[model samples]
Target: MAREYLNVRVDADLKKQLQKLAKRENRTLSNLVETVLGNYAKRKSS
Candidate 1:
């Protein structure tokens, strides 16, 4: 699958938390972001 680049601005604390979660879960930043976005879409749709 092809992926496009997205530029988003987030706070330092949020970035740090996301990095910690990615490291703990052995997931890449991209995958973590994708999972969060997918979940958000599902919740909003329903």
Candidate 2:
């Protein structure tokens, strides 16, 4: 499947923390971000 890309700026410390969290979960950083944003969107829209 094809996928689109998104680019955003975040604080350096936050970026490092996200990377660590993703590693601990054994998921790619991109996948982690997608899951997080997807959940947030679903909660807000309902």
Candidate 3:
């Protein structure tokens, strides 16, 4: 699939928490967020 940029606004606390988790998992925060959004879009489309 072709990739596009998405600019989203999120709460600071949530962003920090996710950033920490992403670091621990050895993944970029953008990759983590994309995984979550892709899963959500697929589930909602079904």
Candidate 4:
């Protein structure tokens, strides 16, 4: 699949929290965000 770039600004604390979760899950921050957003989209579509 073709991927596009997205730029978003987030709070510092939130960024830190995401980073921690990403590290724990052995995923890059971008991958973690993509997976999370994908799941959210699936839920909303249902």
Candidate 5:
């Protein structure tokens, strides 16, 4: 799939929390966000 850049504005605290989770999961921040969004979309569609 061809990926496009997404610019989102998030709170600083949320970003830091996500960064920590990403590190623990051995994933980049972007990957973590994408995974979270994909799961959310799937659940909503279902």
Candidate 6:
């Protein structure tokens, strides 16, 4: 599948938290976000 970029503004605190969580999970920030969003989509569809 072709990939596209998404750009949005978020608060500094949220970004920092996400960065920390990604580090703990051994995933890049983008991968973490993609995983979370993908799971959310799956749940919503179900």
Leading candidate by lDDT: 5
Q: What is the lDDT of residue 44 in candidate 1?
A: 100
All candidates' lDDT scores?
0.94, 0.98, 0.94, 0.99, 0.99, 0.95
Model 5: how far residue 20 lies from native, Å: 0.1
Estimate, for each residue in 1-46, the C-alpha lDDT of model 2 and write its tens digit. 7899999999999999999999999999999999999999999999
For residues 8-31, what per-residue lDDT tens digits would candidate 6 score against the true structure?
A: 788999999999999999999999
| Better structure of 2 and 3 per lDDT | 2
Q: Count clashing pairs, candidate 4.
A: 0
Candidate 4: clashing pairs of residues: none
Ranking by TM-score: 5, 4, 2, 6, 1, 3
- lDDT: worst 10-residue window of model 5: 1-10
**In model 5, what lDDT does residue 19 have?**
100
Report RMSD for candidate 3. 1.1
Candidate 6 — worst ten consecutive residues by lDDT sum? 1-10
Clashing pairs in 2: none
Q: Per-residue error at 12 for model 4, in Å?
A: 0.4
* lDDT, candidate 3, 1-46, per-residue tens: 8989999999999999999989998999999999888899999999
Question: What overall lDDT, based on C-alpha atoms, would model 1 receive against the true structure?
Answer: 0.94
Which of the two candidates, 5 or 6, achieves a greater TM-score against the reference? Answer: 5
What's the residue-level lDDT of 2 in candidate 6?
Answer: 93
- Which residue runs of candidate 1 sit more than 4 Å off their true CA positions? none
Tell me which of candidates 3 and 6 scores higher on TM-score.
6
| Candidate 5 residue lDDT tens string, 1-46 | 9999999999999999999999999999999999999999999999
> Local error of candidate 2 at 7, Å?
0.4
